[model samples]
Target: SQKIEQNSEALNIQEGKTATLTCNYTNYSPAYLQWYRQDPGRGPVFLLLIRENEKEKRKERLKVTFDTTLKQSLFHITASQPADSATYLCALVSGLYGGATNKLIFGTGTLLAVQP
Candidate 1:
């Protein structure tokens, strides 16, 4: 069995600053990790995905790092603005329960609030 967890609390930061969120996992070795952003009443939008062998991945102002050795992943947003305020989630394919379907299991998610 594998479990995923993200910061349960909301993060407050000033606009134009950087926001960093963490994702931790236990009891499984996933082939990759993914990050997504979700607004209230909306489904999560895919942000980035990093393979276990990849150290880092970047897209626009977003960067994601996956460290299999530590069973953790980090998601970063640079030059963040108030529009960036939303809930961020980390998801991974469950190796134990996901046999051939490769089901995705998501973390609790972390709320980010960028204040101007």
Candidate 2:
């Protein structure tokens, strides 16, 4: 019954602006959350990992917030440029039982388009 959803539309914006994206979920209590960036035809690169107890996390130009009560997470990219354009993925991780794998479940990503 666990599910994740990100914006399906491509976000088009001018360079040097901030890009904000949303991720919503239902029916799951995750221990951790992660954000990743993926280019076309390539695997995702980890950007940030936040625990359920953490309210906010930041790294360089990126920031993320988790709300376990609402089952949602938000991703933000400040001072974004054309080079920052890509698909962003939000993932949720839960503790697995014995002999099981602790894996991150990914949402369908949001494509960002930065215009110069």
Candidate 3:
């Protein structure tokens, strides 16, 4: 079993600027690191997915980095917009249920508020 730290702080940033959010974990090694965006009362929308073997991954204005040794992953959004405001969730694969299956452990999530 692993513990996922919750970052309850809200991140406020100006539109057109870059917003960087961090995810830290302890007690388990995840096979893959994933990021998601969730709006109030809605399910999370998948964002970035990085493998443990990969150091970094990028798509358009979104980028993510995984450092297994540091037990952390970073999520970045370039030229952020007010529409990007939402709660960001950090998730990783776990075997808490056992049997070589992938179950995800999600963090409490950090809220990002992009102001125009």
Q: Distance (Å) between predicted and true CA of 69, model 1?
A: 1.0
Model 3 misplaced stretches (Cα beyond 4 Å): 96-100
- Per-residue C-alpha lDDT of model 3 across residues 5-50, encoded as one tens digit per residue: 6478999999999999999999988888899999999999999899
Worst 10 residues of 1 by lDDT: 94-103
Provide the TM-score for each candidate, comma-separated.
0.94, 0.93, 0.92
Which candidate has the highest lDDT of all?
Answer: 1
Q: lDDT tens digits, residues 1-116, model 2?
A: 77899999999999999999999999878888899999999999999999999999999999999999998999999999999999999998755645378788899999999999
**What's the best-to-worst order under TM-score?**
1, 2, 3
- Clashing pairs in model 3, backbone N/Cα/C closer than 3 A: none
Give the TM-score (vs. native) of candidate 2: 0.93
Worst 10 residues of 2 by lDDT: 93-102
Q: How would you encode candidate 1's per-residue C-alpha lDDT over 1-116 as one tens digit per residue?
A: 66899999999999999999999999978899999999999999998999989999999999999999899999999999999999999999976654778788999999999999
Cα lDDT of candidate 1 equals: 0.94
Candidate 1: pairs in clash = none
Error of 3 at 31 (Å): 1.3
